[model samples]
Target: MDRQPRQSPDFLEALSARSQDIFRRLVERYLETGDPVGSRALSKMLDMQLSPASVRNVMADLEELGLIAAPHTSAGRAPTQEGLRFFVDAMLEVGTMDETERDQIARTVSGGARGGRVEDLLNEASALLSGLSHGAGMVIAAKSDMMLKHVEFVRLDPERAMAILVGQDGQVENRIIDLPPGLTASALTQASNFLARHIVGKTLKEARQSIRRQSERQRAELDEIAQRLVESGLASMIEAETSTPTLIVRGRANLIDDAMASDDLARVRQLFDEIETQKGLLELLDDAETAQGVRIFIGSENKLFSLSGSSVVLSPYKDANDKVIGILGVIGPTRLNYARIVPVVDYTAHVVSRLISKKGEL
Candidate 1:
């Protein structure tokens, strides 16, 4: 049931006020309980006096317009994806978190008055969103722009070695690279020293360019194995940079029911399988964002989100200069409360960007 939504919500304006009111109530109740709303339920929820028969006639018209559908052979109806989209874009009101809630978000991300490393701040924000929203939270962070304090290579085995990169601000990260045949401890030492010489106080991208310019003259300065190790370690560092930003996901259990209801388990399984192959998920984060910063992608017309039957509320967090260095958001079933979660995600991103800006000032 991965149906497509209409391109625009303008058609929603043509519905009579009676039809629109019924549709809104129907969608609201369905989102509230994750179940269909019957005509009797709609009649009670409505402010004006309306008969069940009148509501049923309106529901039939809504069904024909592709706004709502019956999930089973029953009188109850649920909002279609298109219906939800229209309600969000047109009829829904975005709710605001109370002052206490906003303060909690600020304190959680900033680690209480003082800020931590960029990595720690992002992880904290992800956990906070998951706990508050009751959904899996994700953060995609870029490391290419960060300055380096030290970089080293350690041989794990004959065929593999590790590259550990330490940021100037005490952020430590490591990546594994393949070792060339017949290499020795001397080569590892040579590679580590070579990178330390050129990579000090330079970003991975800058270091690569700096080292390559000196390669021809430095060629006679080191053995062939050492040169390869230097290039390999540096390449791995940059390759592990922005294009492969570190993905932090938390509260996956919130999405998986403990009872493991058959239908719920099936959707959870599908979601896990797509996340395990994260290419589509990463791409979705990259493509997610609007002039307003927060963008919502529901099921269908997307990669991981479509197959998982999930929706993502994503926003990009920027650096001191306002460059989009990463993304953060919530992921859960389509039945999530968009009115509530959207504002939380938007505010959390704001807090993260503010903390990063303040960290840069320090």
Candidate 2:
């Protein structure tokens, strides 16, 4: 879906208390059952005395304002994508999770992290939110900005070599790189030695820049074949790192369970198929990371999930210094319970931040 302008506050302000209450009830019921709601049903649900005809008239005004729409000619009305955004922005009432829910999350994250890596803790967060929300859960595995301790090239095959990067914290990552044609064992050794000599102690990005500058100055002194190998190893690894930050996804089956119709199931399947390659969704999470708190992207508001008509609720986790490092959230149909999930995402980030602070101080 193409981006539409954000909903104006004027629309909400113009609505009467009755109109707002009726709209609120409609959304609540739709969220509960994933079905369109008729005016007769809404009429009975309203606390005030109003006939079904009166309720339908109010719904007509809402539809005209682009907040609601009838999905079928005969069926009742459902919130439009715009209506969901409007509700989320203006009408949603968020509540703190009770002690039981909080304990569940705490147990899941804390139990999973007992003497485990921070990555494992965050991965547990993904599974926790997916299980709670019944949606696809995800966490953006922040790239290690820790300074590099060592970098080496190991030949795995005649055609390819692996670039292994070890960080100061002892975290290691390996990227497979294509070998330059006719490259020799001696050239590989020279390249590895040059990288360890110059690129060690720099972040991956800094190491990349360092290679370019040092290579230019030492071109005449450096072996030509070794230079090619060094460039290839750094370039390949950096490209791979940027294109695919480790996105930990869990509980995709919940999406199928959430599907309400054949078309809904098909869209969920499309989402399942494309989600593996959705490198673009990172940009949306990046926006959330830079923001102050929890962020919500309704259907079509973010282009990557527009096709599936899904919503995302994201919060960035921080480290000891409270710097936002990575994002955690759930993706499901636009009708997801935003009020319930928003606080969960927010508190989960807090939990993760505390976990990191403890480990960092240790």
lDDT of each model, Cα atoms only? 0.79, 0.80
Clashing pairs in 1: none
TM-score per prediction, in order, is: 0.91, 0.85
Per-residue lDDT tens digits for candidate 2, residues 265-318, read 888876766677764666855775657778788877777777777898888878
- Model 2 ranges with Cα > 4 A deviation: 1-9, 146-151, 157-159, 166-170, 190-202, 205-224, 260-263
Name the candidate that leads on TM-score: 1
What would the TM-score be for candidate 1 when compared with the true structure?
A: 0.91
**Model 1 misplaced stretches (Cα beyond 4 Å):** 1-6, 112-115, 215-219, 258-262, 289-291
Candidate 2 lDDT trough over 10 residues, lowest sum? 1-10
Query: How displaced is residue 358 in candidate 1, in Å?
Result: 1.6
Q: Which one is best on lDDT?
A: 2
